[model samples]
Every structure is written in C-alpha cells, then in structure tokens.
Target chain A: MKLPEPIIIDPQSVPSLRWGIIGPGRIAETFVAATQKHTSQRFIAVASRTTGRAQEFASKFNIPKTFANYQDLVADEEIDAVYISSHMSDHFEHAMLAINAGKSILVEKPITYLPEEAEQIFAAARQAKVLAMEAMWTRYLPQSTILRQLLESGDLGKPELLTASFCADNRAVERLWKPGGGGIVFDMGIYPIAIAQEILGEPSSIAATGKVRPDGMDEESYSLLNYESGARASLTISGIATLPMLASCSFENAVISLGEPFFVPSSISLKTKDFYPEQTTWVDESGIAGHEGLSYQATWFAKYLSEGKLESEVHTHAQTVANIRTAFEITKQIGAKPF
Target chain B: MKLPEPIIIDPQSVPSLRWGIIGPGRIAETFVAATQKHTSQRFIAVASRTTGRAQEFASKFNIPKTFANYQDLVADEEIDAVYISSHMSDHFEHAMLAINAGKSILVEKPITYLPEEAEQIFAAARQAKVLAMEAMWTRYLPQSTILRQLLESGDLGKPELLTASFCADNRAVERLWKPGGGGIVFDMGIYPIAIAQEILGEPSSIAATGKVRPDGMDEESYSLLNYESGARASLTISGIATLPMLASCSFENAVISLGEPFFVPSSISLKTKDFYPEQTTWVDESGIAGHEGLSYQATWFAKYLSEGKLESEVHTHAQTVANIRTAFEITKQIGAKPF
Candidate 1:
C-alpha cells in the first residue's frame, strides 16, 4: 500500500500578489520571510501601530512602503491583498478594514475571536467581491494534502476517534493573561480544533474543562467533541507544560498518526488493523522545515486570488466560522472570559 | 542520573498461602497459571457457579479440590486466601463472602461497581482481620517502581499534567454492552484512572463526555480531572476502537512517558527539560511478559498477608474507593447506566 503524492501548485507558477502586512510581529516576520524566500508573493507595504516597527520590518524584508497605521496600508492602491497578522484581539478589526477596502485578505489562524465576527467579516468581503481566507497554513502543507487524499480514498474506513494535543510552557507571555488577549483556547487550542473541524466537520456538541488564571485567562483546557457519526475527538491544549504535540485518528481499518508537532511539517504513519497488519510511514520531504511551511498558504492564497475565488476552497470562510464556534463553546464550558 | 531499582520482595521468601479461586474465568486461569509458575503460592481449590466449570479449572490447574459453590470454597479450612476474579458486578458479593469467612482476598481491578460497595468490602475485611487488595497489577510492575522513584526524587519535579487512554475495539464483547457488565468505565477506564490516582491523588472535580450504546453502556468516554494543586489529568477510554494506549505525565523538570501497553511490563522514558535536555529510557528486564506479570501482585499480596497488613500500601483500600468514585462520576456525567 502506497501513500499518494501531494498535488501541489508550484509557487512560481501562481500569480504573485503585491501584499501589505498589518501587525509586524514574530508571526508576520515568518510569513513575510518564508513567502519571499519560497514563493513568488511580494510584500509591497508594512504597517504597525508602534511608531517605527513598520519601517523596521520593511527594512528587514526590503519592502519599499511602510505605514504607521493600518488604514493607509489597506487604502494603498498598489496593494492587491492584505495579510492580517495582528494579535487575535485585533484580527476582526483589521480583517474588517481590509475587507471594506476591497482588498483580498488572508487572516491568521482564528480569523476572529467570535464566530459572529467571522461571519460579519466574510459578509463584508462577499459584498465587496474580494477574496478572504484564514491563513490556516497547516491545511496548505503538502503533508496535509496527502492526508486528505488518503482520507478520501476510503482505505482507512470510517474514523472512530481522534486524539490530539497542543501544549507548551508559555507563562512568560504577559498578553496571554490580559482581557482582550486570546487565552490558551484561541491562541493554541485553535490548532487541534481546526484540524478536528477539517477532519470531522462540525461537532454536534462539545464538552470542555479548563484551568483559568486568577486574571481570567485559561492556562489549560480539554475539549471533547462528539460528532453526529459517533466519532469523537479528544483535544487538549495547555500553556503550562510542554507536551507531545501528537494527533492521531482511529479508523475502522487503520490508525493514522500525525507525528509530533502535528501542526507542522511531519510524518504520517498508517497502521492497518488486519490480522497481519502492515504499517507504512510517510515523511514530509518538502524541505520547508518548521514555520517555513507558512509559505504554502501564501502561494495558495495567490492562486485562489488569481482564480477569482471569493474564498479559499482549502480553508473556507465557513470552516473558519465553525472552528471558532467550537472554540467559543469550549471557552464557555471552561468558564474562561472570552477573547 | 540513575533510575532507582525496584525493592521487590522475593515471592519465595514470603509465606505461601493455600489459595481458593472464585470465578473460574479466563482471567482466573491467567492468575492461577502465572502465580503458580512464578511464585511459591499454591492453589488448593477452585470454585464456579457452574458445576463443571470449577472441576474443569481445577483439573487444568492441578488443584486438589473443586466446589460448585463459592461458600464451600471459602469455608474450606485449608484455604488461607481467596482470589476473586469474578465479573465486576459480582465482585462485591464474592469479596464480602471471602472477607466474612476470615479469608484474605485479592479481588480484581475495580474491586466493586461503586465506591460504596468497595467501602463495604474493605470494611468487612477490616473487621474480619484479613487482608484485602485490589489486583491493580500495574502498580507492581518494575517500571512503575522506577516511575515512582523518579517522581519522589524531585527529579521530575511537580507533576503538572497527565494524559492517558485505554481504548480498543471490544464491540465483540457482548458483556461490555450489557447492563451490570461494568461497561467501559469499570472495565478499561480503571487502568488510566488508577494510574492517575497514583500520580495525582484525588481530583477535586471531574468533567466527562461519552458515547453510550443503545443498551445504555458507555462505548467511549473522555474525562478531565482537576486537582486542588492546579494539576490536571486528561483520560480517555473506548470500547469501540483500538487506540494508542500511551500514558504520560508532564512534570516541572521532565516529561515521563510509559511506552505502549503501559498497564503492563513496558519501557519508561524520562526526558528532562533543562537547557540541555537528557532522555533516558528503561525497559523492564524481569522477563515477566504480559499476563504473566499478574504474579507480581499475587506475590506482593502474599507478603502483605504475612506482614499482617489489612490492606496494600501500594494500592490502598482508600485509593481503590477513590478511583471507583472517579469512575462513578464519569459514568454519571456521561449519562451511562451505572453498573
């Protein structure tokens, strides 16, 4: 039994988009650097609220334009699209600003804090006839495409259970404990929840428990999603410890394990449940190690824009809404203050 | 840093007891076979509710006597101890009968269906001046001893999180779906719950969700346990699918993983979280494979009986009750019918 090769659109083959980046933080840096290095995407302008952070980011990336505020960046006619990489709390505002300006947008994971906000952003984007997509880069990775092919091939049969966790020690991040700041749920929990949504669709119900800091930020959480087909996904996220970030699904015929750091470029192993079971492992040889894989989403976004699509078919507007809705239910059940 | 060696008492050094078995089931065969082969423990009699079953088991194990009724087996003056491997629903009745007859007893895991029943069984044993221990054989494994020592030595530091799962495709086991059959909670769930109790102590609160069979038995479940010290354990159990049966604990200084099939003789890996992390893996070299490891608990029971202990210190009576109580809560929260 062989795993199928990923059908990837070469980055250079896709139309390049002149992009403006909002919120020049660490993730934004990775997005800009990786996209420029690996894809034909271009960064025309950079924006940051802080006085010179925009220029500093622009200088490092050799971008020609810089804006002190996001408004000017979105209004720039030279920018074809905007990548919103601000704090999760500001994703809705910046995404709305980009959508209203008729600029195609690629927002980071958790397009907005609330599902309703995501709906509003997509609604405005639809009205403006501009493409909008959540930069759920994991979906665009070559390994993920291979996984999708395997799932669609029906070799594994029906999925019965899924277990995934995203945990790390991030106690030093002060914003994580603040009111508008995305707590563990939005910041880290979205990965497992998004992947679960991608695999299981929308869950019928969610049961969750979590530990919250005195300041109302959740430090850790566990959410159990029950699907209509009786498939369950047990997900765990923590900001208090470093755990094995592994994800696996138990199907009727085999178990598929997405190797450690499952959200990144990793290996996939399929072990059949036959009497004489055969195990096959496929490792991502894309050579786009770590966050460099972020370039996949950038290139895909450019291709979607060139195709004149209103939303990404890979990580759709509906999926972004559903993922955040699941996260919302988890936050509500855990009794944490919502972002 | 070296892992601690297990301080195991030689089974031959402990005073051997003339044993009478209640419930001549598959597990009982394993218990009798492993104990007789590995330890000085001797089985004098066997009993089953079915007339020929006792005689069959007795003939197979080379026991001297057989009884169709448990009363006669417990009343046998030569029998010093009774090994109750009855169905979980009958554990309380069998254990109480053995305890009331002034016979030491080693009941199977999940000593009883409910915490109250376990309490009654332990109370009867206390009044009868006899030893009573839950056959939570995992605690007696050599790797478990090393895990305990690592936690006690302040090398792993304070445990912050635990994740464990005991899942398999047990749909063919008709008894698992029947009322009073113990379901998934009392059956496979006890393993992870018992280990969690050993490591994290009693949880202050539990949140759980599950899928129940049409017959009202739980087929799968997920539980989140919160401790007063802010530590947490996430546990999952299933009767519908075969899953990765891995257990791990995240501590302040290191993360320890009990390799697959963790409830039996397996490997232990300790990876420290220092600037330069060190990983050490230890495999059990005792050569006691699988069900054969059941003998360790029997031999330990013999030693505890010789020491005149009313309950095992390794898996205390209170610990058994607490573990059952946690399972009870899970069943209740998941809306499964109680056994």
Candidate 2:
C-alpha cells in the first residue's frame, strides 16, 4: 500500500504578522526562536510582570518593544497578535486580555486549566471576532498532516485502538508540585490526550487511575477512553520516570506508529496486515528538527488569520475544549486536585 | 552500570518425570516438540476425546500408550504427571480429575477462568499430595529470571510504573467468539496480566474499559492497576489488531525494557537515568527461539517435582490465583461475558 504524503505549506507563502509575547519563559523562547528563524512572522514586543525581565527577554529576542505588564503588551497597536506563553493557570486571563484588545492570540496548551475556562476564552474571542488557537504545535507538523490523511483515506480501515504515553523524570520541577500549577496532567499528559482527541474524537467514556503527590498534584496517571464505535485509547503520563513517547493507532487493515518523541517531528511507519506483511516508514525531511518545528504553528496561525478565520482549522476550539475535558475527567477520577 | 546475569539451570541436572498429555491440541504438540528436542522430560501417554486423535498424537510423538479419555490417562499406572492442554473452559474439570487421580499436573494458563476454581484445584492437589502448576511458561524464561533479579537488586530503585501489551489479529479464530471459549482475555490477555501480577503482585484496585463483540466476547481492552506503593500498571490486550508485544518497567533510577515479543525468548535492556544515560542490552544466548523456549517450563517443573515440591516456587499458587483474580476483575469491569 502506498502511504500518503503530507501537504507542506511554505512559511514564506503566508502573510506575516507582528507578534507580541506574554510571560516570556523557556517555552516562549523556543517559540520565538523557531518562528524567527524559520518563518516570516516577526516578534515586535514582549511582556513580563516586571519590566526588568521584559527588557532582558526583548533584548535577547531583538524585539523593538517591552512591557512591564501583559495589559500594556495587549494594548500595543503595533502588535497584531500575542503568543500567550504564561503559566497554565494564567492562560484564561492572558488570552482574554489579548482577545478583549482585539488581538489574535495563540495560547500555550492545556490552553487553560479547565474546559470551562477554555470554552469561555474561545467564546469571548469569537464574540470579539479575534482568532484564538491552542499552540498544540504537533498538530501542525508534516507528520500529523500525513496521519490525518491516512485516517481520512480509509486505507488503514477503521481505527480500533490507540496507545500513547509521555513520561519523563520531571519530579524535581517545583512548579508541578504546587497547587494550581497543573501538575503532569497539564505538563505532559496534554500532548497524548490532544492527539488522541484529534484522531478518535470525543470518547464516550473514560476510566482513569493514578498516584497523587502529598501536595495534591497528580504524579502519574493512566486513562482508558472508550468510544461509541468500539475504538479505545490507552494513555499514560508521568513526571517520575522516562518512558518511550510513542503514539500508535491500530486499524483493521494496518497499524500506524509514530516513533519516540511522537509529539514532535518524528518518523511514522505503517505495517499492513497481509499474508506477507509490508512495512513502510516516512521520516521528517523538512530540515527543521525538534522544537524548531514550532514554527509551523506560527505560520499556520498567520495563514488562518489572513483567511479571516477566528479559530485554527487544524486544532479547532471544540478539539481543544474536548482534550481539556478528557484531562479534567482523568484528574477527577484519580482523586487529584482539580486544576 | 553492569547488568545482572540470569542463572540458567541445565535440564539434564533434574530428574525427569514420565508425562501424560490430556487434550492433545496444537499447543500440546509444541510442548512435546520443544521438550523432546531440548529437555530430558519424557511423554509416555497421550489422550484426546477420541481414540483416533489420541492415536495420531501418540504415534507422532512416539508415545508408548494412548487413551481416549482424560480419566484413563490420569489413572495410567506408569504416568507420573499430566500436562493439561484442554480447552480453557475445561481446565477446571480436567485439573480436578488429575488431582483426584493423584497425578501431578501442569495446567495451561490461565489455570482456571476464576480465582475460586484455581483455589479449589490447588486445594484438592494439596489434599492428594500431588504437584499442580500453572503453565505460565513465560515466568520460567531466562529473561524473566534476570528481570526478577534486577528488580530485587534495587539498582532500578522502587519501580514506579509498568506497561505491558499483548495484541494480535485473531478474529479469524472461531473458538474465541464462542460462548465459554475464554475470549481474548484468557487467550492473549493472560500473558501480560500474569506478568504484571508477577512483577507488581496484587493491585489495590483495577479500572478497565473495552469493546465487547456482539457475541459477548471481549474484542479489546485496557486496564489500569493501581498499587498501594504509588506504583501503576497499564495493560492493553486485544484480538482485533497486532500490537508491539513489549513489556517495560520504569523505575526511580533506571528503566528496563523487554523488546518486542516480550512474553517469549527476547532481549532485555537497562537504561540508567544519568547525566549521560548508560544503556546495556542482553539478548537470549541459550539458542532457544520462539516457542522453543516452552521447554524451560517443563524442565523447571521436573526440577520442582524432584525437590518434593507440590507447587512451582517460581510462580507460586498464590501468584497464579492472584493473576486470574486480576483478569476476573478486568473481565467484569469490561462487562464481557464471564467464562
């Protein structure tokens, strides 16, 4: 069986937007670096709670403006959109701040701590006629496009089972243990959960079990999502150990697997169920590696904005809300503190 | 860190028993072939429901006697022990018959569909002063011994997580879909569930969800087993797709993984969590491949019997019952037809 190819969009072909950064952190640094290096999108301003940090980040990223407060950044008329890289707990406030100012916004994932928060943010953005998208960068990668095409093609048959896990030794990360810090569910689990929702849609039911830290944060978890069509997904996430980050879907006629670090640019293989089975593998040839692929989301966001869209067509608002809802249900079932 | 080595026992060092076969089926053929080629254990009698089938199996294995009934085989004066490879639904009855006849028996996994049945079989064997062992087979592999030692050594720290999956396309097998045929839970899920129980012991609770076919057999399933020590296990089993049959444990200090086809003779790898992670892989060097490793369990059974043991020390009766109990709970949670 011939595997489908990804429909690659050149970053230069999209209309560039003057972007502002909120709560410039480590991930924000990667996002700015990747977008600046690979896409035509430009970062014009940055903001932090303190002016000193904002100035430092602005100087590092070669931005023209810096803000002592996120409000100032969102109010800046020179900025067309804001990348909300604030702490997960602040995503709702930051995103709404940008949307109220009529600036299109791309918020870091989990998008918000709860599904209700995300729904409110998107609803506000929709009413304001400003675009809002969750920065689920994996959804914009070329491999993800191929995966979507594969599922749509129906050549692999109906997907029966999906398995994905994200685990790493992040036990020393202090933020994860704090109340409202969102823990591993938001930090790592969202990747697999988002992808599962992307492929299998909303599950009919979910069963979850896990370990919780003394601080009331979930340390590790396993969730089994059952769909109405008899499709199932098994998701595992942890902050205490390093596990193979693999995502795979088992279909009636074939099995498609995304290699380790599945949420990033990686290899995808398809093995057909035949008397003499045939296997084919496709690897990323985009010349972009690791988190550098984050640029794809930026360019796509720009294209969506130019198209007069108020939400990402790839990672839609409904999908983001559904993913967070699944995570919320898992957190509740595990007896962990709600985010 | 240097990995520990498995302590292998030479089959010639043990006193062999005269074995009698009940329900000579496909698996029984593999057992006889592997044992005759790799161990000193001898098969003296063969039995099936019909005289013609018994004669055919007996002649193929060059056995001296054939019995058309399980009772006749178990009562044979020269037969020291019986290997029960009967239909899963018949395990309880066949095992009780052998124990009543004062015959040692190695029953195929699962030993019985329910924990209560297994308890009765072991209880009867104890009263009769005869050996009764569940032919888990995987527990006797050299790699399994090494895995046990690695866990006991504490080099991997307290095990925090375990993931194991067993999936294959067995939809074509008619028996699996039939009522009382034991479905995928008994046929395939037992391997991963037994190994999980072997490594983690009894879990505090289990949560399971799956797809049940129209005929009431479980088509696929996922389970989360939570332990009191904050350890969690995620298990996936299916009959609708072929999954990478790998088992792995993530520990505080390191991760140990059994390569694909983990329930059989395979490679083991240990990766330490260090600034510069160290990885070491050990492959099977005993020249035993695939089902050929079935001979290991037969040899171990002989050794245990010669030592005057009424149960396998490696996979104790308590452990076997615990594994079935886990499976039973999973089956119930998935709402599949009980065997």
Candidate 3:
C-alpha cells in the first residue's frame, strides 16, 4: 500500500491575512520571510522592545508601520493576526495579550513553557472568538500529512515504536541558558517531543534522564514514552552534542524513515513487509524549500480563519497544550530549571 | 581522520582445542556447526540429560564420545574445554563443574544472568588456572573490531550517545516465560545492553520502563544509561514487537551506523562532520556469514587458550559482570520475574 498523493493546497487559494510581527526576533524574521515569499499573507507591522529595532525590521521587510512594543502591534486594527516570536519566557504574556485583543495568533513552537499557560491562552482565544495555533510548522508540511495518511491507512500495521533525535551545538547561545524558559528541552527538544506526541498520542508513562549545563539548564535529555498499546517512543535532544536529526516510525510490518531534519519539507521512505526489500521514497514536491516551507502554516491558518474556525484541526489547541504539558513533565523529571 | 584498518587474525592460524558440548541445545548446534565448518577446532564429545540426545548430537557432529550427563563430559580427560549451551538456569552449575574439572570453558551469554554469579564463575576459573569466556560472539566479529577501532581513532570524536534494539516475536516459547532465568531481558535484551556497555562502559545511572507479560516476565523494555561524561545509551528490547536490530554510536563530530542485526557480521557506515553529505559504507569482507560467523569466537578462544591466557582481553571479566549487573537492575526495575 502506498500513500496517496498528498493534497496539494495552493497558498494563493486562501484569503490573504494581514499579519503583525511581535518581538521581531530571529525566528520572526524567518517566519515573515517564508510567509511573504510563498503565500498570499503579508506582514503589515513589526514590533520590538526597542524603537530602532522595530524601525530597522520594518525598513527591511518594507512594512508600512512599526510599534515600539508588542502591545501596540496587537492593538493595530489593520492587522488580522499576530505572529508571536518573542523570547521563550514571554510567550504566555504575548499570546494572552494578542488573544484578548481579538487578534488571531500563530505563536512559535512551545506556545509557552507551561501547559497551564498554553491552556489559558487558548481559553482566551475561544472567548474572543479568535484563531490560535502553535507554529509547529512541521505539522502542516505536505510530508507530515502524507505520513498521517500512511499511518491511518494501516499500511504500516500498528505503529510500535518511534525513535527521534534533534540536537545541535547550541550551548554557547545565551538565550538557551537564561533564567526562564531557557534550556534545550524548550528550545530544541520540543521538536522531537511534539512529533512523538503527534504520532503516538498521549503516553501513559514517561521516564526522562539527562544532563545539565554548568548553569543548571538542561543540556542533553532522553525520554522514554510508554503507551497502553505497547507503543513506545525514545526521544533525545541535545544542546552540547551535535546529533543527526533523525526520526523513524517502526510499525509491525513496515518502517517509515523520515530523512534527517524530519521537521521540515524533506523526503520520506517507506519499507513495508509486503514489499520486503523494496523501499519507496516520497519527495515533497511542494517546491517551496527550506524555511520557506513555513508558508504552509500561514496558508493553513488563513484558511481556518476564513472559515471562522477558532482552532486548527491539524494541530488542535488541546494537542498543543498536551504536548507542552508533556515537555514540562519531562523537564521536571530531569530537574531542569523552569520559568 | 579515518579509522585504521581493522586488525585481522586468521582463524586457521589459531591452534585447535578438543571441546565437549554440554546440554546439546539449539544454539549449541549452531556453535558446533559453525565452528566445524570454518575452523580447526574439534568437538570431541557430546552430553545431554538423555543418552539418546547425546548420541544423536555426537552422530551429527562426528564426535567419538557421548555422555548422558554434563558431569561425566567435564571429567573426560580427552576433552580440553567445554561449551555450555544448557538452559540459562543451569549455567553457573555447569561452568563451575567444568572449571573444577580443570577444563577451559566458553559459556553462552548472560554468563549466569547475575553479576554475582558471573563474579563467582570467573573467580573459580582464575583459581583453577583455566580459561573462561562468555560466548558474546558479536564482540569477536570483524565488524565489532572495526567499530572499536573507529571509536578509538577519534575520527568520529567523543562518543556521546548509543542507541540499539533487538526485538523478536518469540514470546510463545515456554522457556522465555518459565521460572528460571527466563524473560526477554535475560534472553534477548542482553545483546543491546552488552553492546551499550561495550561502547559507553558502565553507566553511572540507568532508568528502565516497560510492560510485563501476565506470566510476569518482561514483555518489553526500554533503558536509558547515563554516563558521568554526559554520554547516554537508549536501549530497547521486546518479546512482542519485532524491531529492526540496529546499533549506532553517535560521536561529537560523526556517527557510526552498524547495519541491521548489528550483533552479526555486517556492514557499517561512517558519517563525519567534514564529509557531511558523503556517507561511506564498509562491508564485512571476513567471508564468515550468518550463524557461520560464530566460528570467529571459537577461533579467538582457541588462540587465547594457546597463548596461556585465563581470560579474554577484548571483553574483560569485570566488564561482563558489570553488563549483567546492569541487566539485573533493568529487570528488577521493570518488575520482571527473576530466576
């Protein structure tokens, strides 16, 4: 059994969303660059703690407006949605502010460091009748949908185990070791952990073991997730060790080896028992490449907002909170410094 | 930096030992079959609980003598060494018998399933002035030597993580669920755990989580071995799920991916930082294939005996004990039935 051709939705088919960038940081630049390059979405305003930084970002992105702080960006009536890419610790406050302002949101991966904070943000969004999503852009990629379809099709049999790791030499980065929301688990480990949750759902039990940096933040961590169905996922992420970003889902009769850096628009290979030695590689063919693939989520968000949906179906508000909640549990288990 | 060429020692160059078989079981058949087909070592006698079983084994292996009991075989003056392949529960008694009779021994793995038992067995062998070894045949395979050499070369840099799993669908086998030394962890998990200890040495901490059969043996297990150097090994084994037998060592700058069924003579791929996109695969040209590769350990044992060595230098007796101790810890943690 082969995966059906992925549903190729065109970015231009969705209604355009006027976006405002909050805390115009590094990831905000990539988000705006990708969305503007490949989608019908446009960033109308940029905001930063420093007026000069906001003006510089607006000048570079050719935005018509600049805000000295995130509060003003969420207040702009011309903005249909806000993209929150602030420092990790500020995600909850920024997201709550945007939700209460009645602006739709695409907060960066984590959504926030704690599940309770994520829950509050989503609740606020619901009360305001606004759209909210975690920018786990990988979930919206074409490859991810095909993977879900393949899994749901029962071609791979019962998914028994998933092993994934995402690590990099990021120990020198200051933001990764700050007082709050600073650590590899929040910044990097979340990718593998989120993907594991996406495939395996909630784990009945989890065991986490890891190392901490001199500053007491998590440096490297490994987690074992056990489910009632006997399915397990071994997830590892590191800041001090440069590990190959590999993700593989092993089912009863087949295996899906997602290529390195799986949380991106990359290729995937399937090896099924029926085919034995024969493996089929599925290419993304989405044409949008690299971080530009971030456009898919913006396009998806626009479609949901146009349909008056309060939350994304692909990555539900509940799933996002659960994912962060699991991360918090792992962080606590490893005795990682928390915000 | 590249790995040095693996030091190859010819099987035929080693002196042959006159060996006796104890218990005459399934793996014993493979051992004799592989050794006789590839090396100069000779099986002089066969032993089993029944005279008929011993006779049948002797006839198949062209042995001149057959004994109904292991004690008689160990006492035979013509037999210089004993190969113990009895049930896991009988290993300590069988090994002690051979050691007291002044015969060298090569016992099947787990070397008694507990660190204390292994320690006693080795101490007796040392006092008797005879060679004693656990048939961890994978350690003697050419591919294993190459992996060790690669790690030692610093080509891959400091080894930071190791991941391996060996799972099979053999739960229905009665011995696997029986009272004495029965369980997936003892019978199968030892392979991955042994190799993990091989790569990471003894871990400072180990965390295990999994399910148990209604019969009380471990149905599945996952272990995280944490080293003080911050290196870690994630090992998994199951009796219910048939997982790909994979072993990989991740270094700071590169990775060594030992091909599937890593506990065999197989290929290995090297991926380095400098040659990020270029992965080079080295195939096993040792010509020893399948169960026939078991011949390598027989040859190695004969060489050590001829050199008047009481133990193997490659895998020290202390390391073997530590490996079993870790397995015992994992088994207890998972609440699996103990022998």
Candidate 4:
C-alpha cells in the first residue's frame, strides 16, 4: 500500500524527485513550494495557460524550465512527475495529457468537475500503466493517519458515528458563487466525504440536503451516510463558511477528536473510559508544513514512477473514483448540478 | 431577556425554592448536587416508588420529606416544583400528576420521549400557568449562550455549517438502548440539533439515515438539515459507540467546537483567516466537570418563580418544545419510532 508519509531522503546525498507544475495559479505556487519543502522533491519546470505568467513564476521559483502550455510540461523529457493544479473544470484534460505522456500525475481536488471526467483520467492512467492519484491532501496529513489508526485499534471502542465538515469562508471568493467549479461542497466538501468513506467504509445509503447557489451549484451541502455495518456519518462542506474541517469518530468506550486549524490541524485526541475523559493533543513536533518534507506526496509519486507501481496505497485509484461519485450523489440529492 | 449563567448561592443566604425529586439515579444525584452547591434551591422531598429506596435516598441526602409513591410527592402542598428524572416512558403520566397537583416541573431529557407528550406537557403548562421545562442541560450551559452570541453578532461570519454529535460509552447502560429512547439521536444528537436551530434558525428541510435497533428505535442516527439562509448542518448521535462527542459550528471566517463534558467544556477555539490563520482557544479556568455553576439554572428558575414570570427566558416554554419536536422529526426521517 502506498502510504502518504514523507520519505526519509538525505538532502545532501540522495537525489530529489523531479516534478513539474502544469498550472501556475496560486495553488500551483503552493504545490511548487510543497514539492520543494515537503519532501526531497525538486521543481524542474512550470507551465501556465499564459506564457508570461508561467515564465514569471518559473523565474520567481528558480525552476530550470518553463512551458507556455500544459502539453509542453507533460512532454518535458526531464520531468518525472506532473502536478495538475489547473482549474477544476480542466483537471480531466490536463491529467489525461500528463498520463498519456507517461508521467505520474497528481491532480488537484475534486479530481474533475464531474465524475465522468475522473473516470476518464483513471482509465487513461490504467491504460498507460502510469501512477495517478487524486490529491486529497488531508488524507496524506499526519492527523488523518493517526485518526485511522485509532479507529482500527479499538482504542476508542466500536466506531459508531462520525461527523465532519470542511467548509471555508468562501462567500467573499467569487468562484464559490459561480457555476463553474464553484460551491462549498465541490471546493471543500470532497475531503469530508472521502475521509468518511476511508474511515467508516462505503455507505449503503445516503440522505442529503443543501443550499444551492443562484447559478445552480451547491454552495453548501450536508449529507448523512449509512454504512452496511450500521455505522453512520454526517458530513458537510461549504465554500462560504469556515468549519473545523476535521473528522471525529465515536466509539463505545472512548472518543477521538481532531484539534484545529480545521483543514490543516496537526493534533488529535484519544480518550477512553479508563481515563473517563483525558484531553490529549499531538502537535507537529516536526514543524515541516513549509519544509521540503511537506511534499512527501511528490516523493511518493517519484518512487511509484521509478518502481513502476500501478497505484498508491495512501489514495487508491478505486477510492478516488468512488469518492468523486459520492460527491455527485450528494450534490444531486441537494438539488444541485452533478458537475 | 435572560442569560444562561450559573449563579452560586448558599441555601442559608436567601429564600430557597422547595423541590421534590422522583428518581434515584446519577442524573438525579447531579440535580441534588447542583441544587445544593450551585443554586438557592432546596430538596424538600424525594419519592423512589418504594419506601425502602425513598427513605434511603432521603436519609442519604438529608431530605426533609419522603414518599413511597411518586404521586404523594406531587400532592404535597409544601413543594413548589417537581424534578422528574424517572424513566422516559413515565414522563407523561408523572408530569400530568404534578400539573394536576399544581406544582411546576422540570423533567429529564427526551422531554417525555414522544412529540405527543411534549405537546401535552406544553399545553398543560399553559393551562395551569405553571413553569415547565425539559432539563436540557446544554441549553442552559454557558457554552451554548456564548455560541448564540457569536452567531447573532456575526463573530465568525454567517453560519456556513454546523456539525454536532453525542455518543456515550454505553457499555453497561441498557435503559438507554430500550424501545422508547435508547438511541444516539434521542440521547446525544439532540444537543447539536437544538444548538443549530438556536444559532442558524430552523432548517427548511432535513434528511436522515441510521441503524435501527430490534426494538423499533434507531441505535444511531445521522441527519442533514438545510436552512433557508442557504446554510446547512450535519448532526449525528448514537449509543452504539464513541466518536468524538463534539458540537462544532463552521462560520464564514472561523469555527467554534465543543464536546464532553459538553455542558462544561475544558476549552473552545475561535479561528479566523488572518496570515497565521488566527486561532484562539478559551479554556475554562475552573477544573470541575459539569459543575460550572450548574446550580445557577435552578436558581434562575427560582428567581423567575419569585418574580412572577411563568416562563424563564433561559429555558423558554416554546424552545424546549421545539427542540424535542426537532429530535422527533429527525427520528421520523430515519423511519424510527419517535417515542
């Protein structure tokens, strides 16, 4: 299984993974930084819809090469992997371009604006025998791994319920209110849905409700998911508000809750009946958020490419496909457009 | 308008409200301790369904009156109010007795376990001109009041979403699993649902899913509610297991989360989107569990009674009825028995 943990590479002795950015937007800039500091991942080049922006970002980031178009980045001979931080509506095209070019790809969240687009990307990856993963960053974070472990260990008791919300204060952000790739659930909800499935297993039934934007997208959505094991989850994500953005699991003997900065929290709690209710928090002792170790995801891609691995264990191709479909179902229930 | 703050009062300092208790359980003990330490309220009598238990509890707690039959306590002219903490199934009958006896009443959670009973009790309160309320402790907690203030004042921004769960480590508590009120939503889920309505206003529509026990009650429930303001909420509660029993609100700029012991939390967080993601935590300086001026609620009731106010603002006649009905609706959505 592909774990999202950062690889221990000696910066002075070991070579770094060569990753190229295929979109020079703000998220792309953050991707470059993550690839640079989160792991021993090197930024080889950058591509932008606009040549000027790509060249400027390349120069600012001190990358070795720049591409005027996404196709150029995918075909770059020196790039081992491509990070697709394109518009939500463009994920399918860019990811397919990079996969067919024989490079491992990391597509930004929502994977694609629609589930069919995600299916195409996955199918292409399977045909090309290249590594592909939907970048649900929270899945790769340390807090998430700890939560999964706690749930499996019976530390909190039998997992019975979970409630999560991944909303951002996106009301002031124009894209959230617009029809194309806008709305809180599409932008922020994907995380909670995916995480809920990862921890609680596939839901057997779904009940959802939400507030739709004037443009027909779900600006905010809430969903109740029921699993075959009788476990249930309540998940909400919105583009117009701020939520703890963390997942919580309840058990028969104890409770495990995530501590915040919501989306990027570093600590989680494990309390038991023996302790009655002891407050425990795990802070990031590594302080690696802005360091090369943060791009551990890029490093994982480099390994998969070199080792010829078909999929990542941390985020399997099957999981990504399922999650994207879940997002669509939730939206559909809330009276929003599927894309 | 009344604020929900615990008031510290000693019985000797002022006139005490004479009260009678009809149960001998942990929650009953809490009522006793809260009245003794937190409010200027006196336990004048106790009824335990039998002379042995009634005499034992009264002797243990130093009560001045003891009744083998619960009806005797209600008929006592000296008692001003009756606190009914008996089985949820008995609430309607017992409350009717107290109302006929002309005593004000405060009953345990589930508020009779039936919407019909809630309506019955509410109508009776109006007819008798007596103060009657459900002892939803969280509604009277400082955390809830503070949460309301934050929402009304737009501190974190408009409510984007709400996610709350209540699950107990019900390893040995079988009564909680009985037919009438033995599931998570009826037990723990109502806290968050009520809080959501109090803060975000009533939801226009709601969808729910859950695991139903053999006895016709849902053991666990997950519900999604959409408000007219374009806001949504996800709520869950269960007796099957422990997931982080938390109550969290996501707003436009920040989030506020709460959990056990929820009535008196150890800490709370307010996160805003500044450069550093401005996060602040408010931890209680006091180191007591559910002992944070809990007696104040009883005192507030006593004060209201003295002031000739039939309904205290802290626990209004209408809000308690609405909260219980909301719980009933959630269960109704899941195809479970409401009572």
lDDT of each: 0.86, 0.87, 0.83, 0.70
Say which candidate scores most in DockQ.
4
Q: Can you write out model 4's per-residue Cα lDDT over B76-100, one digit (the tens) per residue?
A: 9899999888877788888888988
Candidate with better DockQ, 1 vs 3: 1
Candidates arranged by lDDT, highest first: 2, 1, 3, 4
Q: What class would a CAPRI assessor give candidate 1's docking?
A: acceptable
The model with the greatest TM-score is 2
Better of 1 and 3 by TM-score: 1
Candidate 3 DockQ vs. native? 0.22
Error of 2 at A7 (Å): 3.7
Write the residue-wise lDDT of candidate 2 on B54-160 in tens digits. 89998899999998788788889898899999888899999999999999999988888889999999999989988899999998998888888887787777778
Error of 3 at B218 (Å): 2.1
Count of backbone collisions within predicted model 3: 0
> TM-score of B chain for each model?
0.97, 0.97, 0.96, 0.88
lDDT of 1 by residue, B43-140 (tens): 99999988699889989999999998999999999999999988888998999888888999999887877888999999999999999999999998
Worst 10 residues of 3 chain A by lDDT: A270-279
Report the error of model 3 at residue A250, Å: 5.3
lDDT (C-alpha) at residue B181 in model 2: 69
Instruction: Report model 2's interface C-alpha RMSD after superposition on the true interface residues.
Output: 2.9
